[model samples]
Target: MSGRILIVDDDPVQRRLLEEAVTRFGYSSRVVENGVEALQVLRAPEGGDIDLVILDLVMPELDGYAVLEKMRGDGNSTPVIVQTAQAGIDTVVGAMRAGAQDFVVKPIGPERLEVSIRNVLKVSALEDEIVRFRKSAAGTLTFSDIITRSPSMERVIRLGERAASSHIPILIEGESGVGKELIARAIQGQSDRAAKPFVTVNCGAIPENLVESILFGHEKGAFTGAVDKHVGKFQEAHGGTLFLDEVGELPLDVQVKLLRALQEGEIDPVGARRPQKIDFRLISATNRRLMDLVKEGRFREDLYYRLNVFPIWIPPLRDRLEDIPELTRHFLARFAAEEHKSKVSTVAPETVALLQSYDWPGNIRQLENAVFRAVVLCDDTCLRPDDFPQVQANCASRGAGGGQGGEPRIDAPLIAGEPAIRPDDAAGERSGEHAGAAALWKAQGSFAGFTDGSVPFGFLRALDRNGHVQTLECVERDMIVTAIDHYGGRMAEVARRLGIGRSTLYRKLKDYGLEASNGQDAAE
Candidate 1:
């Protein structure tokens, strides 16, 4: 739910006021003096990151309407909230027709503005999620749809891309909830057989007696339960991709038939007179190591070799910590929209830090459920550490290197480890969140201290040493330091970015004792 907002207004006072309101509401903001500057920011490569735009109708060069028209014409669907001094119906209708998501009158109340922003972001997130899922179900999902910022994942995508260029069997190896099936689907979506039936079969979930019948079509009266003819998963996926999930769990007897199917590109039904040829791509996934299963004689060696032609091993969530922030934001937006939690739109940095500290044994799936629960139960606009008691407890337990049975020691700021769980919690915590948890992954290395002054994104410490919220002056000073470092000591750029004049910036720099460290101003 966290997003950067772009504020476009000719009035300096209005821009400053809007920036402060946005910051106070736990969002980041950028201010542009006119529509021209706004478009410059929007059209910049970085503009894609802006979540919402608060536009003023009356501008010197490019007006709000013009900006909106240009944005829609260029297919830039970024959400916009147009604000004007005039509250006339004509203005509202015109804004909406021009593709503005919402309209606000000048001097809008803080509460009204907050609500409008939340609703707009929620709708946008839900719309995007719907479109993505529709594409996935229609067998058109591509690697571009996969979200990951981790280098390890980049390698995986490169391999998948290479594998997709031809009909080589791919075996995706990963822990449960690590998105093995998603990788399979993306490969199919990118291959020549894309848009064809991408049928899936959970090999482990089917009864052993029916495995052959379910995978290879059976004729009527083929078996006692075969009262009618039925097309099997393999036949249904003809000329497309057949994803066999949990392939390591396939019964030893069925492995022989699966091996034959892959070897000869054909399948023999349970009681068919002739073997049927199938022109389909084969993609298999497993949480267990197929090699280990092969060594144990649980899986066939030939089939293992065939499926392992192109192996893609996805790292667990604990190894991709950098992706947590973006993944959390994605889920926060989607779940908030689905659950109608209009007020829950962002997570406090401490909450994110606490989440990053935990070891997600269930991987991305667990993190997705954790965020969904937090959003559903959160009553405020921002999620704080208090909102995640279970996560905090889990991290504390793991940090101590033991679980409930360890010799416990008294600790300050005691928190109840177990939060009350509702019966409805079952539905929200399922692994289906894996589809979107697509981006959530494990930290690359051991857990790092969040307060060691190395936290990513240069976030100021949320709480003071005494565990209380830091004062505004202290936070302001840290923000200036962060800005100085981010802007490479360009005082003018810092002043402009912070929405302050040169005099005010210098005054604050001196008051905060930052001048000496920032003496080498690139643009004094």
Candidate 2:
């Protein structure tokens, strides 16, 4: 909070007066006779703690402009305020162009000088805050730590690494909870500006009316809530990256403003007379297909193109099933550490297989929740199948045979609408058929075709062959069943584990008919 002010002036009286004024304002001040002395002071580590430089434009040797240029060229960002007797519009412009923050007429009043110093320092403080915020936020990113061995996910990881190394705008596309933001963070970590700010704003979270102000800032009195000047994400992310999560959710009007900012490298804070120049890298992520949205006229094509300069598609967890074991272990470790319980470690192979078999509708987020639930419920060192009751239930319902032993083939569906459950007549007829023929035909088509013959095997096989197989509903059902089993029939536990409120989970359960209990085991 304490700042040092350096006064560089040839006029002895002016220097003394300014120093006295600065001292009264609770700031320590140092006086140098000319720019030469100021430069020397700045170059020397032991000279003084100089936070702001009040320099006179005209000096004998090494004038203020030359000193300013030198400091900037040397990459010094110390705020400079120019004070001169021969002050004109051209002189003010010249000082600013030379990197001086502000200009003041030489016959300066004590109050005006103090105000200028306070204003400059205030701006500097904001800039410092922005830098601090970015560093802290960037450090919070642990995306690369996401353990995944799947080739699909490995490609995403490689893309994330490349994106992180550059300031080019990156757009991450995938299903919700697929770790789009994680990819964004990973990119930030690999970037040259890693040490600077990395800020994230959920485009969908902000109200449509206020998103523009949130992205580009607003001048005081810009709108109804504009009681104070607010710094937008662009300004806050100066010299760093700004991640717009769910950018596809951003309203069209705001999209235009955002596109302008990205293209022009400047932003007009609402109600401001002039646009402020900014330097920042844009990173956007969305669960929605932005290109599809653009074609549907829901999102702007221009904005999409601008944001899509570097597109990274994060494959859904289903597509990267091979990574489940690694991701499960990672989340388990994370939750154990977070919960301060080192005793909890290792998951049963049966449990791992159950997780791998699951179609993660919520993607990495759902997997994380499942692991966290297991960690909380698991009292032993090894996570048993019972630790993930919901997952077990889902596997059982799917007739995937939960656990390694494969219990007596229960006809119960692991999840509602699971294709594994067929009519008694259908099962009886299939019993006579050769197992190899059944396996071959079943393996050749979609999972949906394995149950009801009503689903065309040819169509399902075509889809499976093309690799556009899994349905979102199927994934959702699996996720729902997994959550339920993890909670041991406790709706509250299921909701908490899945990161949704209990009421929401109940609604989903009812919608999916997952709330239907067998009614055989009540008190057990």
Candidate 3:
């Protein structure tokens, strides 16, 4: 009732009737003459914001079903109510299958349409509210802002929650960048002792001679550096939680003292006659296999059993690459403010593709760092591959190292919302190697126009050095053909990423004699 309604119909009388109904419902309306025109209007930048669409069943060029199919295929979830003269069950079922929220029989009643629209809008609002509450609940339950929908992470979080309320020592195992400490902190934060201090100690970073003093504290004049009494991490974490990161790195001698502390809630200070009593919830994390270390006598078997009461393994980022987009958007919002560049906060589709392509060896931390770096370097309102020089350089080096099947494509030109034309392909890659495809693809489809607009330095020098020159028409033609190859001919995304209207993008595809992926000439 508060948003614009799109009325798409071929009949002038029917269109006017629907528009009037829509306006009377306390909403603004737009009237399109046909389904083909409706898609054009919907794919525009403003089209993304349309609240709902009322599509007629019959139309020339494209029908309501076809439009629904296309919209669904493009990942657009805009609510739609399909209107048809035929009240056949089959038509309604087909419309539903194509993602129509509801169907209306023609000779439209104002009450019926009003009821359906209100119901659909009510459902949408409810779904949004549910999502908002779920996010709030996730934050409160986990004591974390780590965003993920990965099934593996969901299981880990659930397990960590149960582990939090108990007094058992928790052992967290995973790769270095897999966010083990976050899990430990979540447990600490959600525990009964949440108000108490939660201390962390890196076992591997401590000097070999100071291990005992660091973990158990020392009395004044305990050793050469004992001019004053020192409080250790374990003492600091008394009545709270102690997170021992890299716990496997503890020396064999220190393992014995740690095992004693777990066996008896007490620790002996260096050069002290009495052992001090302490109560702490222990959570240990390591990137290494502690069982193997125990087998090698580097860790005490008794200590291992004591610490392994609750085991939680955090899955690596590679195992959950599906979460990258969500994580990227979250990081972009955060880093954009930190960098003071709001315009460059949003990433182009090509940047996402490139990010998804890489095997993130350093995991989430690395991805966040890379995004931050790209945000700092971003010169335009949107982030592009050019902004991530380190990532590009890394891919280039990997390609140079020679990979299987063929040489790696380090500098392939990536058209946004497209598959990717190979580096060796003459269509788009070569032209975009220096300036990047976003720059070349953004042009009114010409090399001169690309270079003429602004001398971004890198692309121009690379072009001049490479001795690559081209005419106006070929630039546009090649761009269209190359875009089809890269995107597998997904015209909607190609148009969106190429910064051109869908109609304009399609006409150029027709002019170029290339549109379909089967390599057929579009003019035919």
- How much does candidate 2 score in TM-score? 0.51
Location of the lowest summed lDDT over 10 successive residues in candidate 3: 424-433
> What's the TM-score of every candidate structure?
0.70, 0.51, 0.52
**Tens-digit lDDT track of model 2 for 161-208:** 776767788888887777776677666766777667878898755756
Write candidate 1's Cα lDDT for 224-330 as tens digits.
87899988999999989999987876777888888898889899987789999999899998777788768877678988998899899999887988668768877
Candidate 1 segments whose C-alpha is farther than 4 A from its true place: 10-13, 31-45, 147-162, 223-225, 329-346, 379-382, 399-524
Q: Which residue runs of candidate 3 sit more than 4 Å off their true CA positions?
A: 1-144, 393-524
Q: Which residue segments of model 2 deviate by more than 4 Å?
A: 1-146, 400-524
Candidate 2 overall lDDT versus native:
0.69
Ranking by lDDT: 1, 3, 2
Q: Write the per-residue lDDT of candidate 3 for residues 1-524, one digit (tens) a residue.
A: 23557889999999888888777766668999988788888889778547689998888889988999998888777789999989999998999998999899989799888878755654554444455445433423253345665778979989988998898889999876678877877787687876577788988667667889999999999888799999988899899889899888787788888988888999988888899999999999987778887887667888899889889998888798766766775666667666777555355667767677666656788788888878888887667888876566556655676321122442433333334333322111122234333444345324434544642221212132235544567655655555554454555445534544354665676676564543533321
Each model's lDDT comes to 0.76, 0.69, 0.71
On TM-score, the stronger of 1 and 2 is 1
Decide which is better by lDDT, 1 or 2. 1
Q: Give the local distance difference test score of model 1.
A: 0.76
